[model samples]
Target: MSYEECVIVDIDGTLAEFDAEAVRQWVLGEEKQWLPFFEHMAQALPGVAVARLVGILSAQQQKIVICSGRPASYQHYTQTWLEQHSIPFDALYLRPDDEDHLADEVVKKRLLQRIREDGYQPWLVIDDRQAVVDFWRAEGLTCLQCAPGDF
Candidate 1:
């Protein structure tokens, strides 16, 4: 299928819900402490909106892509997390382990561009940050902002 028909989703504040403490630890780069919390997040259920979206997209045969700022080192846990939530995905592109210095928006823009170049037309992007979704929208990508309470 063409890239334009693809739906890209973010994790963290978008699909998976994380407690404040867990988020704080992750943002603080406390990997040792955050790893366990992240594992728990894997088993944590996603919000209804995300679950419904995943189901509808999967049924339509649309490509469901995960484009998160998460480092690639967490790939295994992230995948397991998605599976545990029964989220369907066609592709997942995470940040390289060394790009911790880059902002999420920068990483997202770059990756989204790459996805387009790779021949997947992104039809929609679901993200939690208003700014991120605004940026995507400004770039002519349709984006949905996930409500904060849903995170």
Candidate 2:
């Protein structure tokens, strides 16, 4: 088929779930002391559903983006998780800015603008947050509602 059918997925509450509690536990205290807990928390939010759906798209050479508010520090964690588990996605777009420990709407918006300006035309965006969805819709872009494990 044509690229018109390509799929682009988001991370938080979509392709993957965020363990804010666990993350907070790590950050609010000695992170090194909670390394295993952090890993466990991230690992426990598995993406089986998304992975299976992605498998279908992968066979067709479709592009996928695991966009997330979480910083890219977890990029390697996600990358390894998906790759080791046979999950398929063309690229991963973790937040690039680190002005703070958390990502805000402005950061997401800026990234979205940059992605579009760079000539990326995602056929459809699968995201849970409506803010991003609304932004995309305002630009006349297509999108899909997604949840963790709906892969």
Choose the strongest candidate by TM-score. Answer: 1
lDDT of 1 by residue, 1-151 (tens): 4535689999877788756455565554534344665766766668778868877988899989899877889898889888877899988999877777776788898888778887888878888876677778888987888765222
Q: Which pairs clash in model 2?
A: 49-151, 50-151
RMSD vs true structure, all candidates: 2.9, 5.2
Off by over 4 Å in 1: 1-4, 20-22, 28-37, 149-151
* Candidate 2 structure lDDT: 0.60
Error of 2 at 45 (Å): 4.3
In model 1, the clashing pairs are 3-120, 3-121, 4-121
Q: For residues 35-90, could you state the per-residue lDDT of candidate 2 as single tens digits? A: 45446645655456766777788787776666655556667776776676666776
